[model samples]
Target: MLAALATFGTSILSALVPFVNLEVYLGVLATRIGDDAAAALTCAAAAGLGTVVGKLVWYWLAARSMQSQWVAKKLSKESWKRTFDRWHTTLAGRPWLTAAVLLAASIAGVPPLLVMSLVAGALRVRLEVFVPTVAVGRAVRAWLILAGVGAVLT
Candidate 1:
């Protein structure tokens, strides 16, 4: 019980920190908890919840700061402008595509969660859509990682 709570807290912290790799963390957690399927699933769920919470912070901040002077200054840069334009073009007018891309990125880590979170915010993805997609993707990924680690160790 205590370990699960600790894992939840650690997952949140790790998710917030850019340097912490979640897959490795889950692998370690799986090893520590042994082959207890219930415990493994609990930890995976906790990690997924933590990841969504942390990523939501980034998404919110980006959305809020879109109109800020600082963001304006950053966007003024040619490179930044190009990046923003690309993201806007790619994500705009295609809700299903945006969701699919975000889900794939969250589960597979192709474009990286940090990048996707920021892009989603900048592109003004609806929170109602973003939250559930990210949460479900993170949960599935965490479960797969834990299960794979358990299989390898046992």
Candidate 2:
């Protein structure tokens, strides 16, 4: 349980600030525990999910707040309008788009949290899909890292 929490927590941390640098933390934990693929994957997934969840909260607030004139005044060239349009048409209304969005972000090396938070706020993707996607991506990333470690050791 604690491990899970830690994994999830790190993801949240990384999500909020793009420069948080989770790799050091992740690598340290994986190395210190004597190397376990499943454990590494679990931790990475949890952390990624935590970040996505945090972004979701931000997205909600931003979305809710955007439904007014006051918020619009602060944006440059009325960016919220564009954000809303893109969010609704490309992401919120579509399930496959969410996966694609998430996958693209991951592939582009966009920080998971930033990706999730922005998508959640911008697209308002359903939590059900967002969370699971995060888990799978993190798991894959962690597994790859473990594999690299194994290669180095041998």
Q: Would you list the C-alpha lDDT of every candidate in the order shown?
A: 0.84, 0.63
lDDT of 2 at 147: 51
lDDT of 2 by residue, 1-154 (tens): 5776876777677666667766666666666544566676667667666756666666677558655676667544567567656556766567887777676565345635464655575455676777677556655665566556644564
- Superposed model 2: Cα runs more than 4 Å off: 1-4, 68-70, 74-88, 107-116
Question: Could you estimate the TM-score for every candidate?
Answer: 0.90, 0.71
RMSD of model 2 against the true structure:
3.3
Q: Pick out the ten consecutive residues of candidate 2 with the lowest summed lDDT.
A: 106-115
Model 1 clash tally, residue pairs = 0
RMSD in Å for all candidates? 1.6, 3.3
In candidate 2, the residue pairs with backbone N, CA or C atoms under 3 Å apart (3 or more residues apart, or in different chains) clash, namely 7-47, 8-46, 8-47, 11-47, 12-51, 15-113, 59-121
Error of 1 at 152 (Å): 0.9
Cα deviation in Å at residue 142, candidate 1?
Answer: 1.2
Most accurate candidate by lDDT: 1
